[model samples]
Target: MSNRGRDTRTARSRWSLFGPIVAVGTALAVIPLWLDHSGVLMGVAVLGLAFACYAIGFNVIFGSTGQLFLCVGALAGIGGYGGAILADTVGLPVVVSILLATLVSCVTGGLLSLIAVYRSLGVIFTGIITLIFTLTFDALLLGLGSLTGGENGFLIKAGADTFLRKRIPPYYVMLALVVAFLLLHGLLRRSHVGWAWRALRDDELAAELAGIDVARYRVYGALVGAAMLGLAGATYAFTEGRVSPTTFGFAQVDVVVLVMLAFGGIGTLLGPVLGAATFTIVDEILIEFGQLRLVIYGALVLLLFLFLRRGVIPTARDFVAKRRLSQASAAPD
Candidate 1:
């Protein structure tokens, strides 16, 4: 058998054990509905799913492409505004608004990618550019006070989906999105392009030596990541019944996106999901501090950086993989 085929088979085998585990875990999610405060539990589930989607997109740029773009929240904000404008001002249906918003986000994300790739900006430079873009976008919203309601933010009218209106539907919708994202992640990870991405991420020069178009792959990753974030943002906008420029500013952009990426594990598919959920819950629990929330959040991120540098998901995954390998090696041939 060819070495590539062998590698593929090995990778598949390594992940096979997780299939049943995931299924079981998914089944367990339904148990929350049987509880008394199912409403809040459902809210947690939905929020977890949404943030997971955001994390996956963040990983596409930071994890797969070896690049940094700190405008995740800003891009998501754009998408939210795009949807809101379509629904409110243009009188379009919510579904149509969502579709258009997603398309707009993808186009914007691609444009960013083209510029970044063409300029050959390093990681730090890319972050700076994106950060500036986010700030500028925020300012533009403020200046467009007539349309965006200035600092007041905009809200959406009620819809048929009680789940969305309350929190249950959004949770299920997010859960479905998570499933779709995992499928996409699996497909990408198993493809030749996925290999190219990993190669580029590890060493761009070496990847180029191996015939990978580093710039092209990087652009692809950024677009894909941005598209996901756009989708998530559109959904979040609908769920919250509002969109605000302030929510997508620099503070929310980097700390939440990157911290989730770090706390969950940077490279793995599950990292962002796990990290986002963890951070969300942590933030809620820390909210009683009123003003100390940010301080505690910073400290938590610092602790993760100093100790669990690779993040929890990646570290746990590696440990389990190793243990399974050891067990398999010890088994009778």
Candidate 2:
């Protein structure tokens, strides 16, 4: 095939891959605009979108690269608090603060990746290292009582004059972020760096032998994932108008994100969004269950893993494709 023909084929493949994702995202984006104007539903949707973005970032590292950086919540907290401090304390503009906060998260992620990847730590060890960071960061947030407001948490005054104070704006912002990250994930999946990451993920030793810079790609994954998580955190702070240790701690960060990614279809483009949406709705419904909520939720998630190990989206995709193939085979030529 000619180079042009190959390029055309690649372009078509890319379109085929992302077309459904884009269509679904568009439909979801219009929900808040045209659907019921209930504050409760709006709030749930906003939270779901924000976490969807966060889960996507987490998926980039753990799902795509097979490196478990479990401190997603901590990274997000850094962004949320960092943005708040910059905007409130230093009096920076909200946009600038958000950008700086994202940068900080990226740096933190890269540093963590350096420790995890450059050190050539095994998967379990990497998770342990990130878990330590998450715990330590939570402690740090509490210890910085004046800055983070400790258990009381700090209110975000920035963007007060803007639409961010309202639920709708934040919801739209989060939706936009989720869509952007999904697109970015798709692009990265087709890029050379993505190839390197996948190569490393499949077989690190073999990838290294093939001259792929395993450490560099790992760091790249960390940086990209961290940046997205940080952006989500900043949006969360803006939406809630507060930053608390609990919001970005272990429960919210590690467990929630992992569950979302796993349930949605790890490594798939639409999995994080689907997972985040599904669990967020579940959370809303189970909120009234109080302590038993966790039990019920855990049982459900366990069932999902037991039955559909690859996750709902990927498994469904496989089933559909297989059915189509069988149908084509049975069809007369």
Candidate 3:
């Protein structure tokens, strides 16, 4: 086959993979119709979307550029508290506050990435740096209780009268954010940015030798991902009408987000959404177990790691590819 033909085939195959993801992802919009009668379930769905947003952003940083950002919750907390302070204390509009908070997260993420690159820190060291930051953020939340409401958190008065607090509207709002995050990832995956990320992730040294700006691309991934995390956290906090240290605590939020992305198939576009949906339901079911929830969680995590290490999506893709290849090899051709 000609080089042009091969390139065209590769592009077509790449896009075809997203057809299912986009279809199912957007189909989440109609979830309200089914759960309209149950505010509790609908609320869970909204939380699921928020988690999905975090996982997607994490994927961009970790899956794309090999940055193990252990402080997903800390960065997201920045957005949540940032939004609360700006909207309530500073008297900014809710939308404006959320946007500004997202930018703050973006800048923070970029700075972290830049520092890692400048210091030539490996993945583990970079994670340690972010983990310390997370611990400090948790401390600040308590030490500066007047502004953050300390341990108890505070109500969101700014958007209370808006539809944002409505049970169904907030779900749709978060759903929209998830779709937009997915779309953004798709755009990056198709562009030269995606190319740089693939190269950088696969082999940083080779990527540098091949003329890719490793530092710049790494920073780009973090900035975009952190923006998504911030926007999701801030918007969800305001809509839920509460902001507390526990809301974005590393143990509560970051651990769950990590599990979701890992189970979803990190680099794949739909992994975060798929993983979030699966775990959200799993969590709801685990609620019935009361005290055994932790045990069940451990069991489930063990099973996931043992059987689906590459995650549901990547493993399934590998299976389908192998089947097709075998059939082609056995054919008359």
Candidate 4:
């Protein structure tokens, strides 16, 4: 094919990939306007979007780079508590507090990467180290009761003074953040850095042999992912007007994020979003299932792994693409 024709084909292929995602996002954006003005529903929507943002960030290091970093919740907690403290205790402006909080989380992630890369840990080993960091961070949060409000949590009264005080505003803010993260993920996926991370994920030794700085790229993934998680954390603080240990604890971050990413299709740009939305909506509905909710949810996830392991989004995409190709092949000239 000619260069111009190949470029045109590539452009068309890119649009074909993202067209559905864009359509879905546009529909979701208008949902608030049509839905009943119920605070509870809106709260659920906001929470889902927040989790979506968190999952996208988590996907960066875990899914894209295959690092198995399990400290997403801790990183987010750093941002949440950092923002809460700066805004509430130090009496700083909300925006400034959030910015600083994001920076703190990013630095924390980078530091962790530095340590892990220094040890040259493998994927499973890296997960164990990050998990230990998560548990220790959780302990520290509880230990600093005076600062973090202990089990009761730290409330951000400044939330009321900001746009986050209202449900709709926060929902929109979160939706915007989710879109930004997705765009960033897409851009990175098409860049050299993203290719380096993918190479490292596939084979660290080979990547290094190919002259790619594995450590540097790993740190970059950690930095980018941690920054997004931190921003999500800041948004969570303002939306809920509080930060607590249980909020970003093991069950919330580790299990939930894994489930969402796995269910939505790890390493895919829109997987986290779809997974978050599906899981959140179903979870809210199943809240009345009492104790059996856990069993039912686990079973569903197990079945998904057994059957649609590539994740719903990726599986559907592949199916559609195949059908289109088959149809095109069958067409007469």
Per-model C-alpha RMSD:
3.5, 2.0, 2.1, 2.1
Ranking by lDDT: 3, 4, 2, 1
User: Per-residue error at 197 for model 1, in Å?
Assistant: 0.2
lDDT string, candidate 2, 1-333, tens digits: 565687788888978878977897888878887544788888778878888998999999888888899899999988899999999999999999999999999999999999887688988999999999999998988898988899999988888778987867788888889888988988898889879978888899999999998888888899999999998898788778888888897986679889888898988888998898889889999999999998998998789888888998888988999999999999956
Model 2: weakest 10-residue lDDT segment is 28-37
Q: What are the models' TM-scores?
A: 0.88, 0.95, 0.95, 0.93
In terms of lDDT, the poorest run of 10 residues in model 1 is 16-25
> Candidate 1 residues 108-213, lDDT tens each?
8778877888999898888888888888888988999887777888877634354567645676677677667666765686688799999988888999999999
Model 3 over residues 163-200: C-alpha lDDT tens digits? Answer: 99898999988888888898888889889999999998
As for lDDT, the candidate ahead, 3 or 4, is 3
Candidate 3: stretches off by over 4 Å: 1-18
Q: Give the poorly placed runs of model 4, Cα more than 4 Å off.
A: 1-21, 324-333
True-vs-predicted CA distance for residue 136, candidate 3, Å? 0.6
Selected candidate, larger lDDT, 2 vs 3: 3
- Those runs of model 2 whose alpha carbons end farther than 4 Å from true positions after fitting are 1-11, 33-36
Q: Which candidate number has the best lDDT?
A: 3
Pairs in clash, predicted candidate 4 = none
TM-score of 3: 0.95
